[model samples]
Target: MYSQLWCRTGLLGLLWLISAGFMSAQTPARTELTVTAMHPAADSPLRLGANFSLRIHYDSPAAFRLRIQGERQGTTIPGITHASPRYGPGAGEAIAWLAFDHLAQLDRILLVAEDAATGHVLTSLALPLTLTWSADAPPGAPAPVWVQELNQHAQLAITREMQAPADGGDDFWVNLFLQAVFLTVPGYIILQIALPWWTRDRWRKAAWAPLIVTVPMFLFVVFASTAGGSNLAPIWLLLVCPPACFYLVFLALFFWLKQKRA
Candidate 1:
């Protein structure tokens, strides 16, 4: 009877292992992908070109193959060479590298991915691509300089026009700051006022307000420095400053009250 019981236990363990393997095999696979042009968004209508990267997300481990089908013109492209999977075992993402330069026309690209084992088409997406030149970076040669020094300066200007700002600075930061201050401050003040106990303790609580604002202000300055006056999103942080300033005043008053209480 003991031998029979031992045999039954071993059989049950093997059956459990087999069931786990079957579940692993049948689990549904899911993935998400974001394909975006790597090129600057504001390149001029004239000198515009196309560059893109495909980010793929998925679950389960499996090999994938990809293809890019598009029209040919005055464009240069480096083909897909390898697959890079990100995230973890159950969920991950893959990025495919692609490059296109000096294209003067509109084009449509269909990106397709397939399962390597069963030859099943796992996913396919179509991307519409277009090119434009820098609004400030004019087409053709720049006008002649008045002096040799002007010519030297012109060369630096020309090179800068070719590059795109990686940091979000141009105008986004400015407007964002404006909006944040105009909208967020009043709301915060009203909320604070509604709390009678908090309002009564404002003097004690206020000192921390400036401390909180100080860090975000430092971050905004750092963000602006890197953006180089190109993108505008950094401006949104300005909206936080007004309320922060108010809180600073409140903090000073709170400190004064604390001294009196002492």
Candidate 2:
């Protein structure tokens, strides 16, 4: 009876050890990412419209990909351009351009790890950055008109294991139509009326019009957005047309009243 009991106990211990080993072998290893080196280092301010490089090391699987994406309204829009290595995680150079403006001056770039086959975001990290731009520096490439139409107010947003947001909609077409009627047509009419009567000397003075209220207000809005939040999609004039028209009319009236008094 004692010999039989010893054989059974030994067999049970062997089975437990084999099961634990199998479970360990079945679990996938977690990947770790490290930025080994980067040019225009984190301390250095980035110039708007400039491209930069980063050298990164990771132990990611062949199925995983590291991507540079821009955050907008809690969702990410495709970044300007991120050319990362196609193969697995190893030391590699990332030459990417982040679209930016005054609002982006203090913003950080977003880097994410994704499972390519599953379209799920597994992890994310923010790359601290700041930007400065000269007037002549090219304007950042604006996101596609339709970008904003994506899940603007999505609750099921960026987090671990969530499927990536879908990127297709009719907002582009709708906005374009509205822009033509309210923005393009009205702008053309205003240009026709003003340009014909204005002298070359007036053009120089008019250039300062934006610097007075428009530029200041735009910058103020950008500052507020940086502190608050920002819309990732850009529909130029869609949001600006109505209010701008009101401002233009009031501006014209204000200038006329001052000139008459003078």
| Per-structure clash totals for the candidates | 32, 0
Tens digits of lDDT, candidate 1, 123-160:
67766665432334345333222223333443554455
Q: Residue 87 of candidate 1: its Cα lDDT? A: 27
TM-score, model 2 to reference: 0.42
The digit string of per-residue lDDT tens for model 2 on 101-149 reads 4334334567676775654565666776544434455434434322322
Task: Give the Cα lDDT of each candidate.
Answer: 0.49, 0.51
Provide TM-scores for the models: 0.28, 0.42
Model 2 CA deviation exceeding 4 Å by range: 1-5, 70-79, 83-85, 89-103, 128-262
Whole-structure CA lDDT of model 2: 0.51
Best of the candidates, lDDT: 2
lDDT of 1: 0.49
